[model samples]
Target: MTSLAAPAATYAEAKDVARRLVEARLAARPLAGIPGPLPDTLDQAYQIQDAAIALWPDEIAGWKVGRVPAAPGEEASSERLAGPIFRRQVRQATPGETPFPVLVGGFAAVEAEFVIRLGADAPAGKVDWSLDEAAALVAAWHIGVETAGSPMAEINAIGGVAVAGDFGNNAGVILGPEVPGWRERPLDSMACEVTIDGRRIGTGTAASIPGGPLESLVFLLGHCAGRGLPLRAGALVATGAATGVHDIVSGQSSVVSFGALGAIACRAEPARPFALGTLAP
Candidate 1:
């Protein structure tokens, strides 16, 4: 696979590039390229994220995976979309009633995911961590909905490398308040019901994630370790989307909850189209 962990930049420097990619998308303008919007290659992205962590001293909030669903009647386990979380967006957990923003000209969708917070580090590239070792690292288990936006549609149109350079296909996230003992719950058989104003729209099982939520974390730990990265202690993991994306409308209410785990019900407010933010110095 292509990676940014190349020879030119040190791990720290490479991470900065990845963080810059995050800023660019949140600050996109003017032209839209096919393969990518960044001036660098996908291989360079590995370095970008590497540097982002080093120079920024940002919190490794959590991990998020994507495309967890492959076929109908199948599970979310076999799919392969994943990424890390920045600290700022992890804790603003919403339960009861919360308001979420939507870009008038942005791509966003809601998905159901299992949120797992770690008590120990799941360093990247470990051949394997025992279940007890893995379980010991976890703190709380919760069901949450991530209202994520991405630059994928346009970036992927050109090249995956291009998409790779674009923000790890993310915008922001919302956790639906923490659930009690979410990890101990039968996440695999956990039933998820996604509703729009009380109408059921989608259904999913926790086991859909290849190895369930924890397995997804294992994959990420392995993936990052191979690149010389650490999963970090207290990192929250948003295992892939158990239920794929659902279209939303402004001013409409969207609520998603899993059986006895946790639930997120929020009102979608569309932001008026306006001039983009001022250019950074």
Candidate 2:
């Protein structure tokens, strides 16, 4: 586990980190290290993330969920972590390769995912959800790719606390076609292979995500509600990665094949800096 050596950060420190991260993101540059002291707890990490969310100008499109491993000397805060996905960053996949922007010198990867789109708003006051209950809210499921990236190069090396603080280490999502009747199929039966630059890198089924993707959605239901950011209709949730996260770079291309169902192809382009108040790609 990555140790959180610094004491819990104060709100001022959290805001400072958030400001630096947001600036770096807008500039499409990399940070040599975390902007400030690493958070000592998950709650502290969320505080920083919340500050960044407030500073960012985009509207939330949905959320992304990732696993949170137990720390060396502490029980895991939760099995999964959540991050906001901005509306402008969400792009629908075309038949040809979609362009995914990756920040040079920053962390970038492709994760095969089973994405869920909500048909209706979640009850704002409901803070607890069961797997079955969470399934009911799902309008449909799809095969997708999570474009995971961050301005902090060592984002993952520092562990989940750092990940949560930096928008759950997410950049955008590439939504593929709908997988009809997904609820009736077993996740283990739906396998996928991920290739980067024409080389096979990872292969797995949704079962790779503990209890499958719905469990990840279940966690987010409670998580967002607790934060008072209840999920709304049409929100997309990129459940935990199905295939392992595979590193990629600018100019690289990736194809995720969900055997028979379909495949998604995308190419990585260097992320460009934009002036504040303008839309982010």
Candidate 3:
């Protein structure tokens, strides 16, 4: 966890940092540090994220949820954190390998994900939801891969506050086929494995996610509602990593398999700029 010794970042300061991060992301360049004062809390960090979202030339396609690991013996401020997944970065995996971009000299990793797509809009005024209520909003569950990257290589080392500030350390996602009869299946039964460069790197199941995937959706429903960013129908949610975050570099190949359901193969490419004014529809 990031120590709260520093004063919370003011809006102007947070925006400046957000601008720098957004610019670095668009240009596929690396930054030496957070461009402004480090946000002392997750709320302050999200303020920075909102500013970056406004500056980004893309629409929100989905949101990715990640665990906020608590230090030993200390309670975590929150169990999970969320970040926007831009439209341009969302890809549908096809036969053979789908390529994802990674910023060299920065943070880059891949996580096997259990994704949920919303079937209907969540009530904007609803701030609390039960597990069943959250599950009801899901259109489908799919096997996917979350591409986690940041211009700051030390983002994770800085803790959740920093990660929340920079798009939840998300770069993109590659969605695979929907898992049929997912509702009746225990998440832990949907075992997953991540292999990078022909070597198995990580393995686990949705059971590893605290409380399970629907609980993650429950958290997001409230988290977004509180921020006035109510989730829309068709939005996707990448529940926390099923296996674990495994590091990779440019040119490496990886495959994330969701047993019996399907698998998505991806190759990493050196990240390229988003071309100054380009925006995805």
5 Cα displacement, candidate 2 (Å): 3.7
What's the TM-score of each model vs. the native? 0.71, 0.93, 0.94
Q: Tens digit of lDDT per residue, candidate 2, span 74-98? A: 7544478899999989988889999
> How would the candidate models be sorted by lDDT, starting from the highest?
3, 2, 1
Write down the lDDT that model 1 would get. Answer: 0.59
Give, for candidate 2, the lowest lDDT window spanning 10 residues. 69-78
lDDT of each: 0.59, 0.89, 0.90
lDDT by residue (tens digit), candidate 3, 12-67: 88888888899889888897767778888899999999999999988999999998
* TM-score of structure candidate 1: 0.71
Better of 1 and 2 by lDDT: 2
| Alpha-carbon shift of residue 48 in model 2 (angstroms) | 0.7
lDDT tens digits, residue span 1-281, model 1: 23222344444554444544444444542123322223344456545545444433346677676643323454434535455567755646554666766554445567787777777776555857655666777877677777665433343333334333444454446775566665566766687867877778888888766577777776667666777766777777787677766766556687787876667787666634224443232
Alpha carbon lDDT at 160, candidate 1? 35
- Score residue 269 of candidate 3 by CA lDDT: 98
